[model samples]
Target: MPTPSRIEHDAFGPVEIPSDRYWGAQTQRALGLFEIGEERFPAALIRAFGLQKYAAARANAQCGVLAPELASAIEKAAIELREGRWDDHFPLTIWQTGSGTQTNMNANEVIANRANQLLGQPLGTKTPVHPNDHVNRSQSSNDSFPTVMHVAAAIEVNGRLRPALDQLRSALAERSQAFADVLKVARTHLMDAVPMTMGQTFGTFAHQVSNALARMDDALPRLLVLPQGGTAAGTGLNAPAGFDGFFCATLSEVTGLPFVPSPHKFEGMAAHDALVELSGALNTIATSLLKIAIDIRFLASGPRCGLGELRIPDDGLTSSIMPGKRNPTIAEVLVQACFQVIGNHQTITIANASGNFELNVAKPVLVYNLLQSLRVLADSASVFARRCVRGIDVDREQLTTNVERSLLAVTALNPILGYDRVAQITATALRDRVTPRAAAIALGFLDGDEYDRLVQHPVNCLINYPTVNRAAGA
Candidate 1:
């Protein structure tokens, strides 16, 4: 049997909305018009909408445009929405209107209907509270959606991604300290080079993460500047005089972030350059994470064959064809996640570029990709730090063997003996399958005592080497 429904009126006539839904005419119309994708807006964006709507009602009341009682009712309903009480009421996907007008209207309708219900009125009454006249007062989808986008992005980056990155950096720094004494041969272009401590290698990874975190912080101030007051065509049409200031003040008070009104309402509504800037930072972070994960997996390639310089944690995940074989599953997962983040950044870049004239029509897709990148990178960073970096073990035996067998150790003798002579000695050692010490001694280049003093002790080559803590600015 058909579900019980109620008729809701709008500018386009009547829309039959389900009786159980809190949404009204506009949202119901959008439900039928936009059947594009299964990817709905995330909870973060919805909660942001609730917060935005709540702040708008309060701002309107303060501006003497909306009645205090009506503002209180809208505030109560909007608070429920912000707390995720009516998530199902927002059923629009990210593939909807480019301006996100449909989703903004969705928030208005849900808040209005629920506010009426709060005032002892039946659903679809549109009586005590009207969605457009009150809930969305002094706001347009063009400005409101972008404002919510900035709020949601800033919250996720600060609350989730920054903490995750800090955790990962701390784990890497701990490992660097733990492996400070394990000396290994550094590789250049997959070939052996001079010797360095494993601590130095891990310290570099920590530094990269630190830089990524710094980049995120750098992008936040711009994100905090909102464009909410730029109603419709950036003219503040039909909005009160100080609506922008009121909105930002209330929003900042509720969110605990320093949100400020955009000085240029026209630029704020017309362009999304600030969000694009944040996406660029996320792109750099993805590149850093990908490099770190790939390096860890390469160093922990095999227990018997490949580099074998590091041992990955055994998480009970075994290859199907090979029993007793444990893979670097955590690092592999991180690498894949980084790849997805990189791709999402590209999508955001293109979407941001698609904006033209007074409003960016690609707001929904742009924010969707940006939030996805943030969530994925944050989750992967946490998992990698906890499961992989913390439990990684250094193969001291392999590192020692590789260091001793490396022909590039001749680099230490370049000052004592000329480069050409050292190269000749290394060539002879490799060709004869003998040690460089033997080859040098037979070639009359150095005595046993001199060779042992110069080449045998790799630390002799690291003249005035800085500690890992100093190198990493710890």
Candidate 2:
């Protein structure tokens, strides 16, 4: 085995970095250590790391950690990194980088090299503006990392999730109006319940989506309350007296995100309750979306072999071996992502609860799970809207057929025919394979005019049955 060559610069001096390794041995080692999943942190996260560093550089200049010239140099280097210059440095496999220390170091090394370059100095150099000493001065892993996490999630939610949700909401609203006249058999536990307009079904989706969007919006404030000033712990240790407020203000100015200092610094630095709580809100939205996806997919299942209530635009093979079968791939992914978000929530809860004080050791696990959750929710929202919600077309004829065939409609007969007689009529209709009207007539439960009146256009009977009417009354 040979020692790998290191990236050296005149400023920070020589670092014993591996030459043969694609990233570094440490990153490779971390990858081996944390073999979690196929789901990588979204690229948005890496870009956000750049944003934080960029903001920090500016703040560093203002705080006198670096003069304007050095700040400008560091800023230019950070912009390159932000524009995707040093993605290789982030190669520390997720496993060994618990708490994202490796990610922090990756940022440090990349910025150091880049800054050294801007200064017309050798690479790996940390002189004029050290990556950690000056560039990352007054900041700690606990603060900067979580700050990036919040910013990343906020950007995703604002730019991606909200737009996708708005699209879904609009689709549902359109469908509701379109489906207003189509009455169908509603199901509770997959059993025939009663009459509900197709429009009402779509309206339910819109309502749920509204709730989800509200939940997602609520998470913003919590996420905004970051620990940027809390260096290493609750106390702003090496930070200047007014640095905390100034640092937050600087972040706000750079990112356009309202980065407010937390009231409880100790709790903020020590616990990830904020992450878990905000993630839980995201999971709640995911859960709502899960229901939306399931209902849409089930409705769009089939024109023959399945519950063919609606038809979705086909894309590709959702199943491997099943020919002519178009699986609800988008809905499936949305539901699966919901499960993942929930699972990540559990991991975050367990991790946060495990810590004693001053720091949660599961920082990497927490942030990793959080990033996963944000990506899943963002991706799933688009999928659900684009693949399922937008392209849907109701099978109006099938809906009518299902509604007409349902013996549950005999409840309309109950008001005039009475429960006992209607029950007998229903049983007889089922046994004799005749219509409920026929059974009612044979049993002499009601005369022709009365039976005709009861089953006439749905609303007549509903008006007679006050309980059912009140329940379904629009």
Candidate 3:
């Protein structure tokens, strides 16, 4: 038979918890009470929690509040957690207490158990490294949870998201330069309107992503201001006088993130406006990515029926019945990922507004959505860069054909021939379904020699307008 369950008692009542589990009464209680979702916190968050506890233990020990041995044990255990050991031990879901109190306790209990084991103490014994007093000496769940959110988000954006975006931008820039001279018909309102180089179009995509990355950087300062010192209600109630400063400095040292104590702990604890701003940046990025992905799909729409300006990478998955159908699989995946990020942004926005007087009751959902958005964007950006943008092949034949076929090419002749003449040429070209060059000559708008001289090169008409000496011609 299984080992008999152990009874743990908290303020509320006694509950039977698994003896083998590292979590204590509060976490056990939460596990039993909240079965809302299967979505647990990711390893990044767990590592962040470890970092927070480790910094706290080190700072508390340095401040002479925690015993040296206990602090050392907690620090070691936190390191293990930070290095991703025993990640599965953190079993609390993201649907726990709004303040993330349960997950915080979950971290506290796991660290306490591991530390106790290191000192030859048995599991569930909260002595030597008591979860609340020693491990969480100068911090509260209110502050620690939010601090970890910032820590995790900062690390991800700096280490993963930014680099991923940079790679994607580089890929797009490479394509832009490679296709610099590949002219194509420009579309406005989904109709042929003008002419532009493929390079110019891709360059705009690169700039949009670059701007989004800058926005993420701009929001970093706000995220770096942490709420670690704000214990119960942002008043530093049970924490020592200099605990905030020491904690921030120690955490910064530990994580390499420039974390500073929030001057107004109330704002940090009560409102997640910094996260909201970051989410807004992420939303903008998703919007840009959505546009980029959709544009790719549109350009690679059909080899026979639609604008086949691009050739998508053949992912080897052909349609079962259609014989040969190469889908824009990578672009579609990026598009779907961006859609999720956008929806997650809406969730974050609504959750951010749920902040009450001195505390926000939407911490779990806000952090959940924030992390999800970051992960999705980073992954999507990488895939898009490597599989989509890098492998993209320009359909030069289609591009050239469309450029010559477009009626808007007639606009370049306006400066030399006058707007009335150009407009008449365009109308006739559209109605007769002929090239503007053919239409102009057919309509007797210009002599064959003059028309030939003016429309000497289609590319020059689109990009480099010839300096037509109308006075000489007239």
Candidate 4:
């Protein structure tokens, strides 16, 4: 076995616990147990947690509940955690027994131990910075965990997903304008229906993204409804009278986020409707991604036997047995990501609603689901957009050929030839492998003048590709 690297420091004095005691068990067990994997706590989440602790200290200082020196000490310890400086000290298991009591206690113990060092005292001492008294004086896991969730979600979305959306929109805009002259057959229920420019298809995608962004903007404010003022049971029992308002104002200033004081602290703490609402916005984004992924998959279906409207980049080996088979793996991954995001939304809803009147007992699950959903969405959206959507190349030849071969182009002739005559024109053209006008004239549907007038007077009348191209070119 390896020598014990147990942390000897305490919050107040020298370490008094033995090797067998659980007082220092966190450091020993956490380092030993989670050794199987190399994953550490997320740097972004740690930063946000540190900012929360810092903001909490400042907020408490306004009421003078947390003294200046102690508040400063908390800030120092949180800074260490944020910088990952105390990797050895943060040995508490990520999956703790008390529903994130370990993470919360990890911060408390770590901060308290460090603050005692600042005061020339042993670790675990509460004289300078009592982890619960001064550090978490006016806060609860009920409030802090969700607060960090919002902070991280907002940061990720603003930093990553929004930029990706803009990239996709811009790429589609350029593709739309580029494909304006290329005609393609639009299908309804996988059957040829109408003629449309491929550019028009891209324009529709752009509009859908624009609407998703609007929904995102509208849903984010609900997350700002926080439960910070509700200390234990939404009574402000130990907090000062005006601390809630001033705390929110100062916290907002420090974090550069708009933090609104909860008007209904009980509801905020007991119910995670805010989180559910935010997750629903993520579900919306996922739905959009799924639609876009579906479009990409359909457009790039096959090289010889499919629509093949666009070419997707082959990133890597798709199959072991098939030598030259490239797959839409990126779109598959993103679509699966969307599926999980929706599942995470449902988890949030069920977890939040399962709580009691004043506090949600499933805080760990709440943070886990919310963080997972936001992280996956923010990263996956950006990745799929830039790597897949933006890189797609249209096959103009394939698209135009498909459109030209489609018999639905004669639908515009219904006004001149009536529905029965138009159907006859399409059927005869398909059967004889000739132009619809030639087939129609052969069947005595019209004479030369009538055929010319019927096909040319109305732009929708049956016309061969060459004639249409010549007219368009002229």
lDDT of 4 at 215: 75
**Candidate 2 lDDT tens digits, 391-449:** 77888789878876767777876766578877898789889988777887888877777
lDDT of 4 by residue, 10-60 (tens): 344344333322234234344545444443445556566766777777778
- All candidates in order of TM-score, best leading: 1, 3, 2, 4
| Model 3, span 1-474: residue lDDT tens | 986777766678887778788788888888889988899888999999999999888888878889899999999999999999879888888997789998999999999989999999887777777888888888888888888988999998898999999889888877776777789888999999777878777777877777777888999888888888899899988888888888889888877888888999988889899999999999989999999999989999989998999887888888889888788888888989889988998999999899889998899899989999999999999999998899888999999899888888677687788999899989989998998888888888787678767665555543432111111121
Report how far residue 244 has shifted in candidate 2, in Å: 2.7
Candidate 4 local lDDT, residue 88: 52
Winning model by TM-score: 1
Which candidate model has the greater TM-score, 2 or 3?
A: 3
lDDT head-to-head 2 vs 4, winner: 2
In candidate 2 the C-alpha lDDT for residue 365 amounts to 71
What TM-score number comes out for model 2? 0.87
Local accuracy by lDDT, each model: 0.89, 0.72, 0.85, 0.69
Clashes of 3: 0
lDDT of 3: 0.85
Off by over 4 Å in 3: 1-15, 447-449, 452-458, 461-474
Candidate 1: C-alpha RMSD to true structure equals: 1.6
Candidates 1 and 2 compared: the better one by TM-score is: 1
Residue runs of model 1 more than 4 Å from their true location after superposition: 456-467, 470-472
